[model samples]
Target chain A: MEHHQSKSFPISHVIGFVVSLVLTFGAAGIALKTNLSFKVIMWIIGSLAVIQAGMQLFMFMHLREGEDGKTNLVNMIYAVFMVIVIVVGSIWVLTSGHAAH
Target chain B: MGIKWDEFFITGDPLILGSQIAILLTMIGAVAAITYLKKWKYLWTEWLTTVDHKKIGIMYIISAVLMFFRGGMDGLLMKAQTARPEMEFLNSQHYNEIFTTHGVIMILFMAMPFLIGLMNVVIPLQIGARDVAFPQLNALSFWLFFSGAMLFNISFVIGGSPDAGWTSYFPLAGKEFSPGIGNNFYAVALQIAGIGTLMTGINFIVTILKMRTKGMTLMKMPMFTWTTFVTSILIVAAFPIFTVALALMTFDRLYGTHFFTVSGGGMDMLWANLFWLWGHPEVYIVALPAFGIFSEVIATFSRKSLFGYKSMVFSILGIALLSMVVWVHHFYTMGSGPAVNSFFSITTMAIAIPTGVKMFNWLFTMRKGRIKITSAMLWALAFVPCFVIGGVTGVMLAMGAADYQYHNTLFLVAHFHYVLIPGVVFAVFAGLYYWWPKMFGFMLNEKIGKWHFWLFVIGFNVTFMPMFFLGLNGAVRRAYTYSAESGFAPLFMLSAIGSIILAAGFAVFCYNIYWSIRYADRNISSDPWDARTLEWSTASPVQFYNFAKLPEVKSLDPFWHMKKKNEGLTLFDSEIEEIHMPSNSWLPIYMGVIFGIAGFLLVFEWHIAAAVAAIGIFAGLIIRSFDYNEGFHVKKDEIHRIENAWRKTEGEVHDHVS
Candidate 1:
C-alpha cells in the first residue's frame, strides 16, 4: 500500500495554493480597481471564495482519498448546506419586511 | 482587583448560605476521607492521570451522576417554591438563579456527559478496537469537561448564579443588566467544555473511520456505532458554532463589545439565531445516541436482529441533517413572518418522519420475537409511548401559527419536557441499566430497578401533564408565583407532589447501586444478557487491553455470530505478542488546572493574572508538542499472566454455576 505512492512533491497542493492566491487577489483587485457595480463585484468575490474553498478541500485536504472518502464528501456538502441555511436564513428573517425592527 | 469582597462572597440569603455551608462541609469531608484512606498516590496514578477509555468513561459517569443530583436538587427547589400561590420559600431573584443553574447544569453538565460517557465506554469496544484513536486526547477532553463543570458549579456559592435564562439572551445577559460574574461563568465554562466535546467528536470520527477491525464495513457496524458516528459528526459541525457564539458573548460582556447589545449597530437577534443554530442540532446530538441505545437494547432483548438496519442508519443521517435546519422553530414568535415561519415549520415537522421511521423500526424489531421484560427493556418499552406523546406534541408546536398560542406558556414547557425527558433522559436510564453489568461486574437489583422505573415514569407524567392544561389556560413559565385566584394552585401542588415522587425514584436508583454492590448475585458471565455486539466478547468489567489479540469482525453482531457458531470465543489463539498502549500523563490535568485558573481570573476581570495563567497553558502545550514518548508495550508474559488470572475467575464461576 505504501509503495503505490512514494509521495515526493505535492504538486497538487502547490497548484491549489497558487490558484487560491490568484482567485483571492483577483477578487481584491476587482473590488479595488474595477468600476463594476457593488452587486457584480459581490457576486464575483462570492464565486471566488466558493471556488477557493473547494480547492482547499479537494486538493489540499485530500477529502476524497480513502474508503470513507465518500461519506466525508457527503458530510462536507451537507455542512455547507447547513451553513447557508443558518447564515442566509438568519439574514433573510432578521432583515425581512416583518422583522421586529 | 475589580472584585468587591462583600458582594463577591454572596451573603445575606439564608437559603444560599445554608447551601454554601453544606457544600463546604461535604468537600471537607470528602478530602478528609480520602486522606484518611491514604489513597492519594493510588488515586493520582491509577485513576486521575489514567488515559484508559474505560476508566475515563467511568469517571465521566460518576461526575454526571453527581451533577444530576445537584441539578435535581435545583429542580426540587423550583418545585417547592412554586408549589402553591404566594409561596415565600424563594424570592424572585433566588428563583431566577436556581432556574438558570438548573437548566444549564441539567442540559450541559448532566445530559451531555451522561451520553458522552456511555459513548466513550462502549463505542471503541463495540467496534472491536482496543481504544479510541487518541486516548490521551480523550483523557484531556474529560478533564477539560470536568474542570468546566466545576467552574460552573462554583458560581452559585462564590459570586451568585446566572439569573438570566439558560438561553442567556442578551440585553439580559449583557453587562448592563447582569453586572456580575454569573453570566461570565456561563460563557467561559461552556466554552471550555464545548471545546472538549468538539475534540471528542473529532477523536471518535477518526477512530471509527480508520481503526475498525478487519472485515467490518461501515454499513456492517452495529446501530449504536452508526449513531455514534453520526452524533460525532453533529458535534464537530455544531460545537464550533457554539464556540464562536460563546466567544462573541464573552467579548460583549467582558470587553464591552457590541456583538449582542441593543446599541452600537449590534443585533441581539443574532445571538438568538446563532444559539439555536447550534442549539437545535445539540438536541439531536443527545437524542440520536439515545435512539441508537434503544435500537441496540430493543433488538437484543427481543432476540432478533435490528429491523430495517439500512433504513435505521439512513434515518439517523436524515435526522442529523434535518436537525440543523429547524432552529427557527424555536423562535416563530420572533416575528420572522409566515414565509420564514412556514419554511421552518415544514422542516420542523419533517423531523417527525425520520423519528417515525425509527419508532416503527423498533416496534417491528420486537414485533414477533421473544421479548424479555428485563429492567433495561422496560425503560426502552416505556420510551416508545412517552416519546410518541412528546413527538406528537412537538409536531403540534411546529405549527408556526399554533406555536403563537403555545409560546412562552407551560404548554411549551410540557411539550419540551415531554420530548426531552422521555427522549433523552429515559434513554440514558435505559443505557445505564443495559450497560451497567458490562461496566461493573454485577447486575443492578432487578426488583429495585423496576420500582425506580415505574415511579419515575408515573411521576414524570403526573408532573408535566398538567402543564399542558395550564398553558392552555394562559399560565406562563418562569414566573416565581401565581395568585390563588389564578386557579393554578391545585395543579401546581399536584406537580410538586409528583416531583417528590420523582425524587424518590432517583433515591431508589441510588439505593439499588448500593444494594447491588453489597448483596446481588456476582457469578454472572461477561455476556450476562446473552446480547449481540463485539463489546460483549470482552470480559465484563472489560480488560484494559480490551482484547488480548484483536478479534476479527465478520458482521454487525460478531459476538452473537461467534457464539452461535462456536467460533472466535478464545481470541488468544493467535500468538500473543507485545501489545502497544498509550502511557498515562499528568499533562492533561495540568492543562485543566491552568485553564481553570485562567477562567476564574477572567471571570473576576483579573486581566494580568489571567494572562499569566493563559501563558502557562500555552507553555504546557509547547512542552507537549516537543515530547516524543510513543508509549510502552505490554510484553507477552504480562499478557499471559493477566489472561490466566481472568480465566481462573471464569473457571471458578463456571464450577459454581455447574
Candidate 2:
C-alpha cells in the first residue's frame, strides 16, 4: 500500500506571476502619465486589475489543478459575471435615473 | 482628559426612558430567576463554558429562542401600531426603531445563530469527524456571537435600537440624520457577530476539508455537510465586506468623517454598494443551510437517497455565487436605470434556475419512496410548496420593470416573509425535529410537534398572505400607522389577525417543547430513527469525546451499509486509542464579557476607556491562547468497561432472539 500525494505546483505558475506583475505595473504607469480621459484610464486599470486577480487565482490559488478544478473554474467565471452585472449595473442605473439628477 | 458622563447619559424622550427602565427590570428579573433556580453553577459548567459541539449547539438554540421572544415582542409592537390607519399607539420614530430592531435581531441574532449552531452540532458528526477542525475557535466564535446579541438587546435600555432598517441604508444612517447611539450599537453589534460568523465559516471549511475520514471524498459527503461548506465560504467571502462597511459608517458617525455624508464628499451609493455586497450573499448564507436541511430530511424521511445529489451540491454552490450578483436588485428602485435594472433582473432570475433544480430534486426524492410523515418530514414537505410560491414571487420581483410597482410595498414584505418563513424558518424547524433525537436521548413528542408544525404553517400563511394583496393595493411598509381613509384598513386588520395566529403558533411551539421533555419516553437506542449517519453510532447522550474509535467509512451511507452487511458487529471495533480533546476554559467567557463592556462603552462614546477595555480584552485572549490546558484522556479500561456493558446488553438481546 502506498500513500497518495497530489503534486503541489508546476512551472507555468511562475510565468503567470511574472506576466501579472508586468501588466499590473504597466497599466498603473500608463494611467498615471496620461492626460487622457479619466474614464479611459479607469477602464485600463480596471482591466489590468481583473487580469491580475485572474492570474493570482490560477497561479497561487491553483484554480486549475484540483479534481474539481474545471468545475471550480466555471463557477468562478459565473461568479465574476454576476459580480460585473451587480457592480456595473448598479452604477449605470443609479447614475442615469431621474432620481439621481 | 476625563470622561463626560453627562453628555453620554442624555435621554431624549420620556417614552425611551420608560422603555429603558422596563427592559432593565426584565433583564434583572431574568438574572434573578436563573439564580433562584440554582442553575447558575449548572449553566456555567454545562453550558456557559462547555466546548462540546452538542452543548454549544444547544446554547445557540437557547440564545436564538430568547432573541426570538425579544424580536417577536418588537414585531407585535409594530403590528399593534399598524393594525389601523393613522392609529397612534406609537410615534413614527418609535415605530421605526421597533421594526428596524425586529428585522435586525430576528435575522442576525435569531435565525443565523440558530442555523449555524445546528450545523456546528451536526455537520462533523454526520461527516464522521469527532469534532470541528478548530475546537477553540468554535467556542470563541459562539461567545463573540453571544456578546453581539447582548449588545443588540442592550440598545433598548441605553437609547434605542438602530432605527435604520436591517439594511442600514445610508443618508438616513448617516450622522446628520441619526444622531444617537442606536446606529453605533447596530454597527458594533454586527461587526462582532460578523467576526464570529467568519470564524465559524473558516472552522467548518477546515473541518470539511481536513477532518473527513478516509474515503469520505467531496461528493460522498452528506448534503448537510455540502451546504455547511458552501455557506461557510459565503460567510468568509462576504462578511468582511460588511465589516468594512460598518467600520466606514462608524468612522463617519464617531469621528465626523464623511464616508457616507452627502455634503462631505461622501457617496451614499458607496454605502449601498458595500452593504448589498455583503447583504445579498447573506440572504443565501442563511437560506443555503436550510436548503441542505430540507435535502437531508426529505431523503431520510422518504426512505430514499437524494434524487440528484450532485445537482443539489452544485445548486448550493450556484445559489451562493448568484447571490452576490443579485444584491443590486434590492435597490433597483433607488434609480438605477432600466439597463442596470435589466441586468440585475436577469441575474436575479438566473438564481431561480438553481433553486428550481433543488425543488425538483426534493420532489423527485419523494416520488416513489416510503414517506414517513414525521414532524421534520412535514416541515420539509410543506416547505416545497411554500418555498416554491415564495420563489416564483421572487422571480416576479426580479423583473426590473415589475419592481417599480412592488418596491417597498407590503408586497415586498410579503415576498420576503414568504421566502424567509417557509424558506429559512421552516427548514430550521425541520432540522430541529430531525436532529432532536440524535442530539437529545428522547424523541420530541410527535403529537405536539405536529401541532407546532401545522399552527406555524397555517399561521405563517395567514399572517403574510394578505400583505401581498395589501401591497398590490398600494400599501407602503414601515408606516407606524396608516389612515383608515387610505383604504388599507381591512388588509391591516387581516394582517393583525394573522399575526395573532402566528403568536399562538409560537406559544404552542414553546408548550410543545416543555411537554415533550416532560412526557416523551426516553429511548436509549443509539440508532433511534435508524439514521444513516455516523452521529447515530454513539450513545443516546453522546460522550464528551464523541467516538471511542472513529469508524471506517466505506460508502456514502456508511452506517446503513454496515448494518445491512453485518448486523451483529458493533459499529466500533476494539482498537482503543487515547482521544485528545480540548479542555474547558473560562477565558472565552471572560473575553466575551470584556468585549461586551467595550462595545457598550464605545456605543456611548466613552472613547479613551473603551480603547483601554478593548486592549485588555485582546490581551486576555492572546494570553489564554498561550496557556495550554492539554486534556487528559479516558483510560483504555474505562473504554473497555463501556464496550463490555454494551456487548452484554447486545448478548441479552441475542439470547432473547434465539
Candidate 3:
C-alpha cells in the first residue's frame, strides 16, 4: 500500500503541517486572549479543532486517498455526529436543562 | 485519600482470606504444572505469543468464563445474604463491595469478553478474511483486556473492592467518600481495558469494511458480520467517553483534581451523564451482535431465510443512533426536568420499535418453517419472551415520572436483569452451543446441555421474576438485610433458592464441558449444525491459515447456498496459493504486563514506579516502530496437506467438486 511513496516535493504535507500548527496556536490565542464569554470561546476553539482535524485527515493522514476513502469519510462524519450529540446534549442537560423545549 | 500499608491485604473477611489462599495455590499449581510438564516454551510460543485470532478468541472465552463464575459467585453470595431478613452472612461493607464487583465484573469483564470472544472467533471467517485488519493489534487488544481484568479482580484481596456501585457515580466514588485505593481500580483497570476495546472496534471496522471476499457487497454480508460492523461503530463512538471519564476520575482520585469532586466548582452529575452516555450504547455494543447470533442460529435451524433481513440491518442501525440520545433515561429523576426528561423518555421508548421489530422478525423466521429445536435454538427461542419482559419493563421505567418510583429499587434491578440476561447471556450460550464444534472438534453433549438450559432458564426466571414484585413492594436495592416486619423475606428467600438452582445449573454446564471433551462423538461433520455462514465452510478446529484458497462469496449465507448448488468451497482445479500469516510476537503480552504494573502503581500513588513502568510501555511502542516483523507464509504443500485432511474426514462437502 505504501509503494506509491515518491521522492517528489510534498507540498500537501507542508501545507497541512503549517495549517495544523496555525490552528492550534489560533485556538489557544482565542481561549486565552479574547474577552469573549466562555461558551463563545469554547465554540470558536472547537470549530477550529474540527477544521484542523479534517485538514489533517485529507492532507496528512491520506484519509481520502485509498480505495476505502469514502468509507473512512463516512466513519469520520458519524464520529463527528456522535461528538456533537455528546457535547450538545451534555451542555443542554447540565446548565439550563433546555427550558426552551 | 491516603494509602496505608497496613490496610493492604484485607484480613477481616474469612471468605476473602480463603480466596486469597485459593488464588495463591491456583497460581502456584499452574506454574508448577507448566514447569513439571516442561511446556513453558510451548506455552510462551503457541498460546501467549501467537497472533492467531481463533487462539486469542479461545483465550478470551476461557477468561470470560472464569470471570463469569467469579461474578456468579458474588451474585450467589449476595442472594444468600439477602435471602432472609437480618441475615448475618455478609456485613454491610462486605455486601456493598460484593454487589459493586458483581455489577462491574458481570457487565464489563464477563459479558463484553464473552461476546467479543465469539466475535473474534467468528467475524473473520464469516467475512472471509485470513485475519483481522491488524493481527498483532488484535493480540495486543486481548492481552491488555485480560490484564486489566486481572488488575480489577485483585483489588478485593489487596487494598479493598470499590464499594461504590458499578456505575461509580462521583461523590460516592470521589476520594472523600471512597478513601481507599479501591475505586482507583475502577478508573485505571477499565481505562486500560477500554483502550483495548477501542482498538478492537477500529480493528473490526476495518476488517468488515475492507476484508470481505469478492462478490460480497455490504448488503450481501451475513447478518452476524453486519451486526459486528455496527457494534464496532458503536464501540468506537462510545468508549472514548468512558476513557475520558476514567481519565478524569483518575485525576480526581490520584492527583487530587476536582473534575468530579464536590468542591472546587466540580460537577458530580457530569460523571453520571458521561458514564451513561457511553454506557447506554455499550449495552447495544454487546446486544446487536447477540441479535446477529440469533439471526444466524434461528435461520439455520428453522431452515428459512431470515425474515426481514434488510429490516434487521436497518433496525440495529436505528437502535445504535437512538441509543446515544436515550442515555439520560438512566438518570431521569436527577431533575433534568420535564423537557429533557420527556425528550429522553420518548427516545428511550422509541428504541422499542426497532427492538420489537427484531423480536417479531425472529418469530416470523420460525413461522411456517421447519424449526429444529437444538439446544442452541432453544436458547434463541427462549430469549424472545424473556427479553420482551425485560424490554416492556424497560419501557415502563423509561417514563420519566414513573422512574421516580423505580429509581434505586429492585424493580429497576429486575428490569435490567431481564433485558441483559436474555439479551446478552442467553445469546452467549446460544452462540457457544452453535459454534462449539467449529471451535473445538466435537459437539457439546445435547442431553447434558438440555439440563443446563432448562435449569438455567428456569432459575433465571425464578430468581428475577419475584424481584419485580419485591421492588414494587418498596424494597430498595443494595440493602444488606431487612427486618421481618418489612415482609420482603419470603420473596428474597425464593430468589435465593432460585440462585442456588442457578449455581447448580452452571455447575452442570461446567460438567457438560468436561463430559463433551472426553466422550462426545468426534467424528462429526465439519458443518455440524448444517449451518449457513462462511465459518462452517472450513474444517472443525479450523487451520491456522483459515481457508486454503479463499472462499468465493456469491450471496448471503454463502456456504448454505454452496451446499444447495452442490458446490465445494473453491474450484478443485484452482491452484492453492501460499498464505501469509502474522508471526507470533511476545510484545503484546509484554506490553500488558508493563501497563498492568503501571496501573497498579498509579492505583496506590506510587508515582515513580508507575512512571518507570510507563517508560517500559513506551519502549514497547518504540521497539515496534523499528521492528520489521513482516510475518511468515504457509507454503502451498502445507495448505494442500491440511485441506486434504479436512476433506478425508468430511468428504461430503467436496464430493461434488469434481
Separately for all candidates shown, the number of backbone clashes (residues 3 or more apart, or on different chains) is 0, 7, 0
**CAPRI verdict (incorrect, acceptable, medium, high) for model 2:** acceptable
Best by DockQ: 3
Candidate 3 residue pairs in clash (backbone atoms < 3 Å): none
What overall lDDT goes with each candidate model? Answer: 0.88, 0.81, 0.90
Candidate 2 lDDT over residue span B231-304, tens digit each: 99888778888899999998998888888888997788878878888888989999999998988888777877
Model 2 alpha-carbon drift over 4 Å, by segment: A1-101, B1-41, B567-573, B641-658
Q: Name the candidate, 1 or 2, with the larger lDDT value.
A: 1
lDDT string for model 3 (B410-468, tens) is 99999999989999999999999999998997999999999999999999999999999
Q: What is the lDDT of residue B273 in candidate 2?
A: 78
Weakest 10 consecutive residues, lDDT, candidate 1 chain B?
A: B649-658
By lDDT, rank the candidates, best first: 3, 1, 2
lDDT of 1 by residue, B318-340 (tens): 99989988998988888887888
- What's the lDDT for candidate 2? 0.81
Name the 10 consecutive residues with the lowest summed lDDT in model 3 chain B. B649-658
Question: What fraction of the genuine interface contacts, i.e. the true contacts, does candidate 3 reproduce?
Answer: 0.41
Top-scoring candidate (lDDT): 3
Which has the higher TM-score value, candidate number 2 or candidate number 3?
Answer: 3
CA error at residue B112 for candidate 3, angstroms = 0.7
